[model samples]
Target chain A: MVAAVKRATQTLLLAVTGAVLLRMAAGDSYLRYVNSWMRWPLIACGAFLVALALLDVFREQGSQDDEHDAHVPRAAWLLFAPSLVFFLIAPPALGAHFAERAQSAVVPVDTSTEVDLPPLPEGDPVPVVLDEVLLRAAYDDGATLADRRLELTGFVSRDKAGTWFVTQFGMNCCAADATVMRVAASGVDAPPDDQWVRVVARHVSGTGDGGREEPEVVVEQLELIEAPKNQYR
Target chain B: MSESTRQDSPPSTSGSTARRAVGLPVQAYVVFVAMAALVMSQQWLVPRLDSPALATWSTIFVAIVVQSIPFLVGGVLLAGVIATLLSERALRRLVPASPTLGVPVAGLAGVALPGCECASVPVASSLMRRGVAPSVALTFLLAAPAVNPVVLVSTAVAFPDRPEIVLARFLASLLTAVAVGWLWLRFAGRVPILHRRSTHDHDESTAQAFLGSVRHDFIHAAGFVVLGAMIAAAINTFVPRSIIDGVAGNVVLAVAAMALFAFVVALCSEADAFVAASLSAFSDTAKLVFMVVGPAMDVKLASMESGQFGGAFALRFVPLVIGVAVLSAVGMGWWLL
Candidate 1:
């Protein structure tokens, strides 16, 4: 009888888990809304538990005989009790404190190459690394071409007067392993730290003073923008 | 058919009658509610905790639970089918008699069939019923999740820069599993729970047995998975990561910390690599230990163990695996990357 009951419970749980996964995959708005509010993974777990419950129900009805009668130990139940209690109470989200401590202090970049001379089409976005910007003038041959403007969008990673680096965080698994990829913006309005923004700039010639490894972006304009929904890659 | 005739009498005892009337229904209701509550809570909680860190953690947790469901369903079903279709004599013949050979073979079998921690418990139980040596069954239980192809592949993917971590995890988990099994056979006596008679005396047909086994395995594994997820969710909510980090920093302290993490996290072997990778602050060794030990020893595994092997056996066995796992992880970390 005990075995039957256990099986029934397990079936019910499995069915529910499948349903929840389906819902999540379907992009249920409520689920998405709640995902924004809490953690989506927790929702996924809840769904799995429901599926398990359903599996249990099915198993109980199907298997009348208890050929596999393994007795559950009291100690195992005791061990499981505390975890159960904690699940009942929803925990807070990870905060900014982790962000500061988790920041990778060392930025590893190769600074040996110096490639010069490529004119971008009008209004085309030019990819500039910090090291690349330091080698030559921001603009080729010191001439500000007519009707040319570069527009770029990224998060405000670092800020200085008239100069800042727009950066994005790339994630492999979770936020815990996020790496920052930054681009320098010079000749533009600098925003507050960590604010996502759009910058409109005219490429200025590089000073050639900054180390060949650390190039700077020279922006002619900058504007702050709202942060995107998903910050990590 | 013969067993059915014997059971028709109902054994005519007041205690047995009361147990039949009250025990089954009460247990069933409890299981039902437990299942409902766990799923409901997980659904409700996950969305409310949104943050990149929280989302990632939750995603890893969910993926683990989600990915393993199919396998768990299959394993439980297979076990149930075996129970109904195969006669005791047939099963005995299928399993090796000798403890020494059986245990190591079972442990090595884990290298082939990778399952999540929850799935393994039921599989282990099924093996016990087939008359495989308890020690051997135990070895398979510990090693299957860690050494399986899916988990190994996932580990490799998670740590693309370091391939050696995958090899290290496989060797360490395999060693721990075999070592524990050998120890159990040498030290432990005959376990009573495994000796319990088969419940299916009805002489059900092969097809029925197959369906029944599938249903049974699904239910059994599903319950444990839910239970495990709830535990992990609870830990994520209440236990601060700082505490985990603080404890996991010391080389010796990290092993014990990971053992405890293994108990609480209940991560599937395939998804555990991501979780391990996410803990960038933790030393590679500690992380490796977490991957190796989490699948083998955890609260979910303990529940399944109690259900399958009997409480007395689980009581001694889980801790034994945990200790060996920690030692193996630490020792391997020292020798390897």
Candidate 2:
């Protein structure tokens, strides 16, 4: 009976976590945690986990390895918590809370070719990531961003002084490595914190344009939209 | 904690009578009730999760767990394959006779096995049982999880712009493994590590045993990983970032702080690079210390060593390796990184 319970717990833990990742990968759900590149591995491992669980379930009943049951093994029960968090809570993507806590890695002002920054595209409202907006503002040559109406999408983040910034994070591996980037915006009604918005704005060359401090984005338009399927850039 | 006492206690007459009265095994009934209540309480918990601290904790916990599942599966699969394909006698022959040569050889051989510390535990125990030298077996145990290809690739991905950090991690971790193995060899007389399990249980066929071991390893490792992630999340969320930010500017202080952080948090080697990357305030070298020290020694790993190998091995070995690891990480950070 102890053997049966052990087998059952292992099966449930793997099978459930695997299925959750699979479900996330098949659609937009996985984007909440990891990037799209991880989808195939997530799906493959999910299937593998389910397969392993099934094999464990159907192994020859009497073929149990004759090792004695260990301690009460309450520890094994903790394995179920991850699956519970996934299915029950399935918490929203990284929000303002994490953004405030995780300091943005300062992008150096070198503007060297090594940063591999791409050329800004030509459009009335050129769509770009918030990281790109901050990068070009802080590091790009003045003319590249001069007079261009760059657009970016990010959730609202507010500083202590009641000023709002459009911000997003770029994940190196998972949400844990997500680095926050923010471009302060004004002249638009404040969206409540954590509400995703697409900002159509351009660099304003004024007193604050030292290219070292908070790079300002003149908010020409602010349209509230549902958060993107994948939150990280 | 005494497993022998918990082993299959045959259902005596009274045991069945009580079980019949409850219409279920008491153990099963208790678990079932607890799970039901826990799941039902989600309604209450979900409302509170709106708080930033709670929500942040939940997200970090979720991320770490999701990130590790693949590597955990991979670890078990690799261990399972090794178990299914290779017999004890066959593997023992691969090592040299002299423990001196075998120590470094086994340490380097770990690069071939891609897994974490938990997977290596069972593999090392089997090696000891097969009459392998304890130094060689212990070296393989430490090295297998740390220097594996999967972990290195993840480390590279975590620090994409700096290939040298990856190189430094490999060299430092390899040096630590070899150094610790030699230390074990010198101190073998003072400290003896008896293999935990003693018996012949190969009666089951290879396929049965292979799947059984896979299930066994996955359940065993995943439980610990989940526990470790939860503890790390709480530390990550509540512990002021100021603790880390305070010392980021000082090289010596930063290294010490990150090393202690790695030990207390006990993150998995595969996913630790990501966590280290998040601490961008710390220099790349400090991050190097965190990575190098983590797989070789951590609070959870120490306790696990005590559980499997015994307190004598764990108590003595942990400090020796920690000291060696800190020195090697600093050395590599100065020279390579």
Candidate 3:
């Protein structure tokens, strides 16, 4: 009876976890947690798990494996936590909430070595990553962004001083290792916290001053926008 | 723990009577209560997550778990293959007879397994059981998760411009593994490494055994991964960077801090490089310490090592590895990075 119950629980755990992975991958919801490269791998993992569960179900009854199954620790059942979190809370992508708590300013870079940055593209409002704008402001030796009007999109985050900024997380692997990149906004009232927005702004000259302060931008145009499908850049 | 002990015991007369009376085993009752609570808690719990901090924490927590699953699964499957296909006779043919030579060879052999440290514990334990030298097996355990190609590639990717960081990590991790092996050999006479065979070694078919091993390894390792992820997520969420940045100026404190941080995070080696890369305030040498110390010895690895190699062995081994790993990283970082 113990063996039978163990088998059933094992099968149930595998199936439920697989289903959660599949559900996450079936849509863009997975982008909330991991990079796009992870989607296919997650799908494959989900399928493999379901297949394993099916195999367990069809395996011969009272098999020799069942006698040895008693050794599996009860702690193994804690594997359900991820599935439980996914199905229940379904936390959204990291946004202003994380950016505010993580760091109020843009991620710092080495300033001793001057960076020879390339010029921005030929457009009145050249589309640029919000973090790249901050980087160019902080590190670029040529002052490439001094006169340029750049279009950036990010959620609104405010520091303790009530200075609001447009911010996005630059993820290396996943949200777990995400670093913040934010550009301070000027000449506009702050939007509601966590509100995603697009802005056509000019980099305020001398604000970044070689990474000492966050690069500030003068907002010429601002528009409320929905958060992108993949929030991390 | 109590439940596990109960499961191991034979069905007593009272247990049988209890099963008849309840119409289900005690295990079933426990599982039922847990599942019912989990399902019932959803509605009550979901709405209370109104705080953005809590939401952010949950997202990062799930993200770590989600990002790790594929690699963990891959590791478990490969471990399953190794368990069934590899034998003691085959292993004996491969490893050198001389313990001195075998230790370094075993360290080099770690490059073959591309999984995290979680996957290496079972494989290393099995290697010892298959008649390999304890020193060699321990070396492989320390090295496999650190120097594997997957981990190196991820390191290279994390520090795209700093090719030297990858080289430093490789050298430091390899040096740590080999150094520990030599130390273990020297101290083996005094130390007791209790080797317990797996509880059930059934004469089952190869395919069946492979599947069973896969199931067991996956369930066991994934559970530990969850535990590690929860701790890591909590640290990431609550621990402000100002506290970490304060020590960046002092080299000794910086290296020690990074080593302690790595030990607690228990991140998969493949993903740790990204984290180290993100900690831009630290010196290159300090970051290298984080990378080297993490894969060789961490919180989760210590627990898993204790579970596999016995609590006595882990109690001694954990500190020894951590010390050697820190020294190796500092040495290599000084030389390379």
Candidate 4:
């Protein structure tokens, strides 16, 4: 009976893990934890777990149960921890609170010889990712960003002095490698922390030589938007 | 099919009747149901988790566990194959008898396997189980994940500007692996870790033994990973990481802080160089220390090793690896970088 329970516990844990991976792969939820490239491995591992569980079921019924009935140790119960977490909590993604804790380091993502970015789109206001905006303002050789209205969207984070920065974390592989990117937004009252907001603004000179503060965008118009399906860039 | 169905179906008996009345056979069932209920109504947790510390904790905990599962699966599969297919005679013949000769070969051989820390734990355990020398297997265990081709390539990519950083990593990581193996050989005496050998029982068929080994290794390693991840999350939540910021400028303090940080965060070996590089405040040496100390011994590795070897083995083994790893990183940092 104990052996049967052990097999049952193993099967249940594997099945639940498989289910979690499957769900994560089929949706955007996994982006919070790992890179998008992990989708295939996640699916493959999930399938393997489910298949292993099925094999256990066959073995359990094949008359191998009665002979090896060792007492299930209490430690064996820990195997269910991930199963419980996956089924019950299914923990959420990194949020504003993590953004508040960042000093900042832009990982040099492109190792190949530096290729110039394509010419900025011509318009009154252009849509740019929060990361691209930060990268260009800091690293770009050309001053293509001068006097151009750009639209940027990210969650709101406010400093102690009642200034808000349109902030986002750029992730390379997972939340573990998440780096903070903040663009100070003026001409608008602060939105509540963690609220998704869009700002139509132009670059404002950030004269600080130190790395902490990046260029700001002066908001001409502010609009709140729903958090996107993929939270991390 | 009938037999399986019979096993799952509850027999009509007084004991089962009593269980049915109470909705379970033991008090543990009430706790399980309560946990499930708490999960269903997790709104209360959201408010408590709204704090930055808890939120970061949750994110990191989820990240580590979810990120490593595929690699752990790969490890278990490799281990299963090792247990069933690689006969003890073949393995003994394959590995050198002398620790002096075998250890370096095992360390160099680590370059081929591509896995993170968790993946190597089971494979090492299986090798030891199959009658290989403990030193050789342990050397491979540490080196395989930390110095593998995938990890080396990732390290190269992460530190492209400084080719020396990549060289320092390879040399230091391999050094740590070899040093630990030699230390184990001299210090551990002649006691081999005995995992409960259901190996004899499962030698019935290749397929059966393979599945059995897979079931055993996966369950054991994954449980410890869960436990280790929870502790890491707690440390992440309750402890302020800003303490390391103070020492980032001092070379000695920076190395110490980075090593401790590596232990605390337990970042995946393949992904850790990127993280180390991201801490731009630290020097090249500090990042080297972070990469070296992490894959060799961290919270997750500690738990996984303890799960595979005995608790006593982990207690003795981890600190030694950390010490050797720190010394090598500092020495290599001074010499190479």
Candidate 5:
């Protein structure tokens, strides 16, 4: 009778946990947090637990071997104490301290694309760059080529002499394997480091030098925005 | 009259029944709950901490667990098939005789069948039941996971800028496995627990044997994996990153910390290189230590050793492996990295 109760308890706990996790996985933001590989084991373990619980409920106790029983050590319960304390008091999120201490590896930039810039409207405040025009051209065939207004979204990566690259980190695996992608913007107000923002810019692509290639994007406007929950690409 | 006399053997019948009663349900229950609790704890603790360093740690942990599942599944299935289907004569033929040859050969052979550390325990246990030498089986258990191709490839990928680190890891782990095997053969005395069989018998048919063995190995291994992960997650949550980083630079301190990290993280050999790579703050030597010691001696491996080889044997064996792995890593790091 005691064994049956224990088995039922286990089954209930596992079912509840599995259902919660599955719901979490099916939610829109699930892909942002966990990968497909992680889901399989949890599902498998839950299934196994349910199977065992059913077996325990129906199988004759005397016929079953002691080896098949669920006997946990008293010491195992002590393992839960630390985790319980932690769940009650959540730790702080990753901060600038990590960025400061981590090795400053430079992100390699590719500079081979060409862009064409339209003339800025009379009395326009911001200067135009070449790369933005190329980016616009690539995606939209330079249609709706507006010298009046344009917009882009990314994080402030670096600030240099009136220019900054709005950057985002792309991850292939976990956060450990993240790589940075950036677009340079000039003539816009530079945001604080690592701040997420949207920028409105005049699209301008630079003409290739006779022997040199320098494609740039000139930003005409900048607006800072709130950081997303997950910062990785 | 002769048959009637033989039927009066009450003592033998009762003795066998008592042994069965004592062994079966107790082992099953202990193994099951232990496994369940351990796995569940890992699931709970990994998400709550949320530090970048912890994120890297969690990735390594997950990768190790994820990568090993296929091999573990394969090994358990194979064990089950062998146990149930293969005749005693066939099993004997399959296992190499002569401990001297078997131990070294098994250690070297680990390179060919690359798998994660989690799979090695069950495979080694299965091999032992099939008549492989304990010393050789132990050597393979230590070496195969450390020096397998998948692990080495992952290590290479993790340290893409440096090719030599991969080679260094392979050499150091191989040497460590051989050394552990030699030590075990020389000093280990009459260890009966290492060879204990709970329910495996030669009489079982292949199909029944296969299913039983697979179920047994899966439950046993999965339980320890969960236990280890829980301990790892708990440690990850409570222990500050600064504490790990504070002692990371000092040579002696770094070595000790790496050894402890190996124990705490319990990452698979293939995935550990990536974890080491992400610890860019630590010296190359420290990272080397992390790679070398992690697969050989960690919480999971210790739990597994205890479960397979008995608590007493594991108590002795784990510390010895830790000591040797640490020293070898330090020496190799100084020389190579």
Candidate 6:
């Protein structure tokens, strides 16, 4: 009886786990946790687990009786926790709350080759990645960003001083290694915390050296937007 | 079916009455109800709970677990192959008897496993269960995530200007692995965890043994990963990194801080170099310590090690790896960086 219960529990756990992975991978929800490239690998892994569970069932059925029940440690049951948490919490992507804690982080750039800053493409309110805006502001002596209106999109985050900044996380592998990038938006009433927004702004010179203090920008326009498909770059 | 029919009778008359009322055994009925409750909570109860801190914690926790599962699955599949197919004679031919020779070979062999630190624990444990030397297996465990080609290339990419940073990381990690393996050989008296076997039942067919080994390895390793991820996520969320950054001025303190940061954040080896490089406050040597110490020992890896090996083994092993890794990174940094 104990052996049967154990086998049934294991099978159920594996099937549920695989099903959840497939469900997450089949939709955009997985982008909240990992890189987009991981979709196929996740699908493959889920399929493999489900097949393994089925194999276990068939193998057990073919056998006569449980004489030597394989010992599964109590720790194995912890496998259910992830599934339980996923179903219960439905965790969103790392956002304003996470960015608030990890504020004003500098993205790693190639410092060895100091090349000329690329000229901004011919456009008013040029759409730019938040990291590049900060990088050019800090490192480019030419002040390439001066007199150029830029368009930036990020979620809203506020520091202890109640200063609002447009914040985005740059992820390398997963959310675990995400780094915060912020550009302070002035001359505007702040949107709701964690609200994704698009801002057309020009750099506010003399406000930041981009060391600990993030560069400031005077917002010419602000529009609320839904979170992007991929929240991290 | 026969076992359940013969052995599953209720213990009491009252229990039997309830079992008949449910039309299924109590255990099965309870499991069904619990699952249904969990599913229902997703819609009705969980949404009303409004705490940003808790939600952030859950996101990070889920991310770590979800990110690690694929790598863990790959490791167990390889371990399953090892458990069923590899013969003791073949393994003996591959790994030399002398610790002096075998340990270095194992460290070099870690280059083959091009995955995260989470993957190496089960593979290393499987090696030990197959009668490989514990010291040698431990060396592979430390080196696999740190010295693999993917990690090295990622290090190079992270520190694009300083090509030496990549070489320093590779050499330092290898040195740490070998040094710790030799230390364990000399100091470890009797680790019962190495002797505990999850080898296949002799009566089972080869296919059954393979499947069973995969399941066993996956369950043990994955469970510990969840435990580790919870602790790591809590620390990552609660602890302010600015406190660690404040110590960057002093050389000794900076190195220690970086090592501690590496252990707590528990970043993947492929991604950690970028993180280390981003901390512009620290010296190059301190960054080296972050890269070296992360894959060799971290909160997650320590938890997994304790689960695979024994708690006593992890208690002894974790600090030793950290100490050796710090020394190695410092020495290599002075030489190469």
Q: Identify the candidate with maximal TM-score.
A: 6
Q: TM-score of chain A for each candidate?
A: 0.45, 0.84, 0.90, 0.80, 0.42, 0.89
Candidate 3 CAPRI level = acceptable
> What digit string (tens of lDDT, one per residue) describes model 1 on residues B210-237?
5545544554445456566556655654
Worst 10 residues of 5 chain A by lDDT: A206-215
- Model 6 DockQ vs. reference: 0.43
Q: B187-242 in candidate 4: lDDT tens per residue?
A: 88565575655433532567776887887788778877877777876765566557
Cα lDDT, all candidates: 0.58, 0.72, 0.78, 0.75, 0.58, 0.81
Please compute DockQ, using alpha carbons, for every candidate against the native two-chain complex.
Answer: 0.13, 0.36, 0.43, 0.34, 0.08, 0.43
Give the winner by DockQ.
6
Comparing candidate 1 with candidate 4, which one achieves the higher DockQ?
A: 4
lDDT score, candidate 1: 0.58
lDDT of 5 by residue, A1-233 (tens): 22321223333333333343344334422233334454565456435434544544564433323333233222233223222322222222222223332222221122343434454345434332323433344332344344456555667755325446666544333322333445556776677766777777654543222212212347656778887655554
Error of 2 at B109 (Å): 2.2
User: What are the clashing pairs of model 6?
Assistant: none
Q: Ranking under TM-score, best-scoring first?
A: 6, 3, 4, 2, 1, 5
Error of 3 at A116 (Å): 3.6
Give stretches of model 5 more than 4 Å off.
Answer: A1-34, A37-63, A67-233, B1-75, B85-94, B191-205
lDDT of candidate 2 over B197-242, digit per residue (tens) = 3212355557766776666666665666677678777876788777
TM-score of each: 0.62, 0.83, 0.88, 0.87, 0.62, 0.91
Model 4 shows how many backbone clashes?
A: 0
Error of 1 at A27 (Å): 4.0
> Docking category for candidate 1?
incorrect
Q: How does residue B198 of candidate 4 score in lDDT?
A: 42
